[model samples]
Target: MERDFDTTKDVVTNEVKAKKSAQAKADAQLWVVASGKGGVGKTFVTTSLGLTLSKLGHSVVIVDLDLSGANVHTSLGANPSHMNIRHYFEGAKSLQELVIPTTYPRLSYVQGFWDSWTPTDFSYNQIQNLIPELKKLRADYVLVDLGAGALEAHLNLFKTADEKILVTSPEPTSIEKTYRFIEAYMCHSLKENAAPDAFGNMITTLRDHRQRTLSKPFSFKSYLKEQTGISYTFFEALSQKPVRLVVNSCRSQANAELGHSIKSVCHKYYDLGIDFTASINYDNAVWQSVKSRTPALVAQPFTPLAGQFLNSCKHLIDPEELRAVV
Candidate 1:
């Protein structure tokens, strides 16, 4: 049976290669999927969305960028390829060479390193160099599953994406951490784009102040008002970056409504516009599929959870307005 499966995969892979060569260079839309905390279903969402996009006739590459704890390959019921991101980082392979064809024809993956092989520290220059190479891949869409937490590396990677998807559950702790992630990203953006010296001083001052006054929320708008020159207008214009939010493991209607509540709070406090795109119900099928090493959609295409994921993809593709389908 294993031999038969290999033969089928090889045939499909060859067919895809032929199709790829016959086509013109793909202008892919890059998406970065991230979360504030670990085990929030970020990888599950990424894989399901990539599969759904491919099923819609778009070629998609899901790159597992969660270097420290990479396991996106396991979710696809596949082992790590010999050529992965680690090889690319070590100069043994080009970014293009790292892409391995999956059993699904339109979906490919750039596998990630295992825990033992994960790098302790990846420099900013390395990440900056990776961005252009990723953009050069020929696919309709590229989904990068980022590591959880708001580390500088993670936030920088999130910023590089054309569109960013932040995943979180209804738990209070998860929501709090998600807000912190957003705060960190906003600070990172300001420091990079605005007056570096002034913003740096301001960030330091704010950090000290926050340590003293733990209950107060940091206000970007208020901070910008006090600043002079480019920093002021740059932050004002930062509102243009839209982040889509997905609420996962929702058990009830109230839990689902947390998406909207978070959006409202962000708009009021952070002056950041967040779109509450989709809420996924707490379904046992999701875990079952994961345990079986199959994507939920592929394992049970007609299930409600699968339908919800598809709807979320449609809304993501055409996000002129929010379509909350829980």
Candidate 2:
């Protein structure tokens, strides 16, 4: 029988290097829409962002990978016959055949295959397995509304995204939770599955902070640095992948400015500058359409909020950005 073994270490290293080189050539813009916590209107942001992009004539597909509660269908007000990501994974249905067109002709969706994928379900290998199917869509933008929280699966989507949009409203509690979420997220992004003792200790410290009586002197930044200092690998990931912070539910420019504040804070720590784009006003039409199971853009395309979202799409896959440089 033939042996399944590598000829030599030199050959193995060369093969590994070649694979990385090949991967570098296969870059596609995967925009991951995520939040540290749920109920911050992440799905709405994902839907609007995809809708806006499609209107700009870019073939856009929003993949609802929210395994816990797959409501991208309800958000869009469409009753998909096959709302199952599991089927796609089991080879029962091809992703191409799974494309469910919405009110917007330019937009379509790939609903979550798994209805009960917990934190464990967001697997890099499983998600990677699905890419060839997604690649067939080959749109200018592949918008992914990753499941909520700071689970490895959620962070993986953030890790793999070409562009990341972190959304949050202005409520103080929401802001604080979002902060904790981002810090935990970035901490993990810099280091995936670190030592057991150290990881457990960090979680304990975070819990302690949450338990503190009143004064919250301890900071997440200090906590991370104390545990894991910036090293070669950390800096390398930061330099390669940066995130953009987006503020939604702006009652005024002050609400929009909150995004800038958050960006400034991230810059102070991460040395990355986040762009503040596309702030939408409090539109009752959003909820109204939700009751009727309709996408706000389709139900009220002419709303001011709708215009802001489409304008965001214009900037997201800007035509000028795609123009070849001489």
Candidate 3:
């Protein structure tokens, strides 16, 4: 495992600091992997996916952004004290200085394993600073495993990256939460720093009929259409954003259909983007990886589950031109 923080001053833009020599075109694409809720094999997928991608000859970095309960190390068999995000958080180094190589060849980890960092440790402004820094890491892929739900911090970080993957299982509750997650993101994104007023009467009507429990009521769609103030077309714009998903713990091709099912729900009701992604099968070794303190990709290389990890990467590989250094 080789971890190189020697970021060349080669790539410089208002977005980057002027560096010296041009480095190999960074296949380094930053990705935010999150689910509507926890226990969806987030850390497992994160660790395994990074290892698999690295094995494919792509340098991979996994940021254990499971902020409050960062279990990425436990799953990856990494030493908790072997220089992590805490080192950078404590003002001991720059982002480049904090990358920790993992057991997988060319794989590394940026851990936020410390729950004690608190809001005071790094201000909201600090997160804004860290975003670009992480983006500039010299690797083929940066997988950020966010804590569940759509909070201001989580959303900001996830949305800033090159791709946003909403991780969810196929269960009823998981599907509903996924919708709720989309609703929240789409609504917030639509406002564009403004407020969600429902454009007045239309919003009020929707709220009133939200749980009318009547035989026939104003549907959320009709509620939107009726609102002359709020353009339905504007809501459709969120569908154009760069977003996708990965259905975890899948069992078969039928299980793979969950992604499209959630896509249909979001497209029909919320009018959001849920295309361009992949899924992981229900592999028992995933549990073993968790229990045995190993990454499934590295632990069970020949399994069907390992193949899914590679598929997930293919689902997210970005364009070489967009990531080109300035």
The lDDT for every candidate, in the order shown, is: 0.81, 0.71, 0.69
* TM per prediction: 0.83, 0.74, 0.78
Find the number of clashing residue pairs for candidate 2. 6
Q: Which pairs clash in the backbone of model 1?
A: none
Candidate 3 per-residue lDDT, tens place, 1-326, comes to: 12232333233342253232344544457888887888887777777777767776777788877766787778888767556676676688776777877756788887665645554233567678778778788886788988888776676776666777788887878877777777666555544433356544544553555456435634455556655455565445445555677888887788888888777766665444567477778888778876877766767788878767666666566434223211
Clashes of each: 0, 6, 4
- CA deviation > 4 Å runs, candidate 2: 1-28, 113-120, 192-241, 269-272, 321-326
Q: After best superposition, candidate 2 residue 131: deviation in angstroms?
A: 4.3
Give the worst 10-residue stretch by lDDT in candidate 3.
1-10
RMSD of each: 9.8, 10.2, 8.0
> Clashing residue pairs in candidate 3, if any?
9-19, 9-20, 10-19, 10-20
Model 1, residue 120: what's the lDDT? 64
What is the C-alpha lDDT profile of model 1 across 1-326, one tens digit per residue?
99999999999999999887755564578899999998889999899898888877778899998866788898888887767788888899998888888898689999987644424656898888888788788887889999889988888888878888999999888999998888788788777656767777777756765576535656657767776643555445545557889999999999989999999988776667778889998888888987898888888888888888888888778555233432
